[model samples]
Target: MTVHGADAVDAAQSAGRTQLVVGRSDIVTPLARERARDTGIEIVVGAAAPAPRPASGPATGPVSTRTDPTPSTGPAGRLTSLRAFMPGEGPPPPPLFPPSPALYRRGAPLPAHVRIDTRAVGGPGSTPTSGRVRRVTVVGAGNVGMIAAMRLAESAAIDEVVLVDIAGQRAAGIALDLSHSAPILGFSTRIRGVRTLAEAGPSDYVVITAGKARTPGMTRSDLVGVNAGIVGSLVSDAVAVSPDAVFVIVTNPVDEMTEHAWRTSGLPTDRVIGMAGVLDSSRFEALAAQVAGVHPRELTALALGSHGDEMVIPLSQATVAGRSVADRLGSGTVDALVDRARNSGAEVVGLLESGSAFFAPGLSAARMVLAMVNQTGELLTATVSARGQYGIDGGYVGLPVRLDRSGLAEIVEVDLTAAELDDLQTAARHIGDRVGALDGAGAR
Candidate 1:
């Protein structure tokens, strides 16, 4: 495989070249891309050159006279004439894809070959009903917040997404970039950026993702004190303008942060939800699917309670193709999957050595927003007030919650074994202690 490094980019820049072309399979280094961006160099992917053909005849001219005893047939040999393929050096390359068929004229009758299906597939009609637009305010321009805003905008369920960050320029840049992709991505949802929450008023949902990210060797609980203040302040300010908006907290130590947001906003217990359980459950499902040799989308898994070590993954509930995970993969594998899922965030953080996971967490938050905006009433695991459920009281715990336009519609109680219930309660108590300490220490 071809390896594209920063040295090659520097060489191209030194040669006064504005573009660097590499094979499609070439491994482009991150530093190369960064350098290219800094130097205004456009990196283009090109097709691999054809293998060298064996000599057909004896040496005839100077071109065929000088031949090395050993010939090179690697990337270097293939790229010896790369400049021939460069723009303005030769004829234009062939089209990568065939042109789309001209089906019909705009303003003309339906084409004879086209037949429309009158059946209703799903969802409400395309446009918002009565122009009752829905808006979501994402508080943060961090990795998780940026990805969450992108996912929410792509969903086409919300009319607008406002990204709020203290770094106003960064937020605006990200918003502008995402907005530019809307036409190409086939989504019309508007994306905007602002420096303060006041500009994001009357939002239907406020997703709280502003907080310290977990670094290597740092546990989610380690961020409790630092994130509580940030999340609490954002939630309090969010409620001032969008009092009816549901608050989805994505800050670290999410279970405790959900409680903090709830208290700060003084909203109903059902309105403030944490974004851990869904992400944890998705991880569990993906891991279980890998072990069971099945597609992850076909597996149903639930991870509840705290978003940290005490997170509970019940063997009785997790299933693949309607079969219990324990029965399919045995208890030992289930245990391993549970442990992996519980520590997946830390695993990513350790690997990155910098930022915690954002892709799954962001999508998880966006999924909750989509459920709320579309009023799908889908049952998803999330952290909500558990004052009387599972014999746990006075804390926000992760559980199966049905979401709709009204936010939390119902808390679905599933039958868990005694041990599973104990584990869940253990997680709840852990979150409770951390949350209590936040208040006791005057964190927010």
Candidate 2:
């Protein structure tokens, strides 16, 4: 009872019946009939049976001529039968799956099962290709860098992670410890520790987090010179070996270091970015919750500009329970909240007394890596090079950017008040001074 392709013709020849049905309307009727006769199977072109009407209808009035019974074994029989059963032209072929309301609401016109023929649509290099991970290397072995390497090894997306550090033994020990945990975690990703920068070789992504941690007495400006020098050296080595790998800068004075790395490495601007504003914004959200007396998850806040005291926290744009915080708390309370937001990092360091915050910073770095690996193209605040964006130029600063596998895609611009603008400019000047100082020291 099952027929397939040319085998259907053989089955017809074996059967005593001389009739064949060609369902394809595109095939010329006469041509099909001829082919059927040549194959010794008579073509029944229009032998479809007519639909029966219900007998319960009253015969009160004269029936129209259109309702007349038609013969079922003529050239027009199929068309007549189709007209009786289906009023208009027969229904078009059904879609493979039912439409999803959610998808439709989101502006996706096609159903989930509607397959696109990439072969037909794709030109030259437009076709989708698989990615291979031959070797993975990480630059820096500080808190963010270590976490990035560990997370990358654990990710199914990459194969291995080579952890590099100035302190070689410490890096090796960390790698060894992470390697031991892999067995219990059920991940097969390999981890290696490299003493010399050259040992890491070419990598898919070179994450930089090797500078000193921020202390309570210091500002990001204070850490700029030391971190810039460290980042500059790391960038030089990383670019020499892994020219194509994306560079993620997570050092303190992130904006300055990121810019220095870009300039030092001579890589494209898109390849160098700093991780800060995302973490800072998360802190802002938490603080907003405390001020509003609500769960942190329900509060939404934005922290823009430099990742320091001069950073801009837009209270006018912040909201809780679908209402602006400015409206809820008025101007004075909002100003206090902004002050709290600006000093939260120092507050955390004061509370710890021994170390700066790590969990949130580590999580922020991991999120950036995940966004890149997944090609999600999500918009987040990261320190990136600027060419006259928001009236700032020739520097790196925290701004919202769309990130994906290709690195920074686009920068999002936000409105700033006069006071916020002044603060940001001051931060930029402070960073510029530190960079100048480092250059002078290097010259000496």
Candidate 3:
């Protein structure tokens, strides 16, 4: 049989058979004809013409032949070979019958295109199919707390968020606002506000931002008696509602308040953590960006010890654009940058003259919430109870902790300078004093 396409012709030529039956309809050039002749083979045009009935004898000229050894017998086979036919052949073998409808119709009761409602399989109006429906509860409805509730409601991993506040109206208003934004945020989570802690029962996580804000000229230490009492009450209520929830303390004096929360909540040490160093380090990064004239993202740093001025920033480990801070701007400038970082919070407080920062602090709390909900085992420096991890005991301190689905997974002990260690101990002692003050108040 004659091959029409260039690939087919090459394939046939490669097979060493130089002769080929071609139709008059075929477009073979004189040069190809000459080449075929030079190869000792006949290029017989119209050879595909049906034989003249045999003329009652041995077929005249050369009987039609198929170049392929296995002649086609099926309809598809006939179409593949049909292009080799001479003109006046009947309609090119009826153009192989359209793919069998029976083949597509087999087995299934109905075609796949038929839309079948899956709700019937799982019962009608059941909660939309999703992974385990995780619930989060944010305690407090102040700025930081509301912002955290909004962020959690925007996350896809959490299915529900309960916002609890002592002031029922405030929590309800914030929750309503968050719920209204769900359509815009493209999240399907439900946001609820409640007055009592009972509404947040057995949540996957509990974020405590219920304490009072820092007034002007007040150190986080100054918030001890007031915020500690507030944190203690909130912790007690939260523990009764969600003993299993991972408690994240975001109150001022976080290191001290976290210790109070753990003691009052009676949760395991691993279940209670405080948000401090991450926010502190964020401030440091911002200040480093100001000095280095680069994006804040390019600055790498860590804050340890407490959440206040006593918090130790590891200057030796700090870097800008992968170069050490000292290398980028020398030691004197680096020291100034460190001081700026250490005082950034106070600077903001001074600017506001009334309120502390909420944006970065809220974002920091949200990051911790996401780490827990998504089960991302990220190492973050959070305030946690010190069981003698860094030679400090009976207090809370900020240290790198592995956060995962279960909350505080592990505390990572990093190498520190002698001065760094001593400063951390001093900060811990400061926090211990605050905790002791709260304890004394409780005695009264």
Q: Residue 367 CA error for candidate 1 (Å)?
A: 0.3
Using Cα atoms with residue i matched to residue i, what is each candidate's TM-score against the true structure?
0.71, 0.65, 0.68
Local distance difference test, each candidate: 0.71, 0.60, 0.65
- Once fitted onto the true fold, the runs of candidate 1 whose alpha carbons sit more than 4 angstroms away are 1-132
RMSD list, candidates in order: 19.7, 17.9, 23.7
Which candidate number would show the highest TM-score if scored against the true structure?
1
Best by lDDT: 1
lDDT of 3: 0.65
* Model 2: per-residue Cα lDDT over 1-444, one tens digit each: 111123444465566444444332212222222233245443222343433223642222322111123222111011211111123323432221111111111111212222222121112222212243555566667666677777666654566778898784878888898899776766677788878669877887778878787777877677866777778888888888888988888887777777778879888898888888778878877776787887664455567777776677766446665356778767788778778777777788888876677777766776676556544333477888767776778667777676666678767555556776666667666666666766666721
Backbone clash count, each prediction separately:
0, 0, 1
Worst 10 residues of 3 by lDDT: 101-110
lDDT of 1: 0.71
Tell me the deviation in Å of residue 399 in model 1: 0.5
Tens-digit lDDT string for candidate 3 (256-348): 788888888878888999999888888887887887898775566778888877878876556665456789888898788778877777788
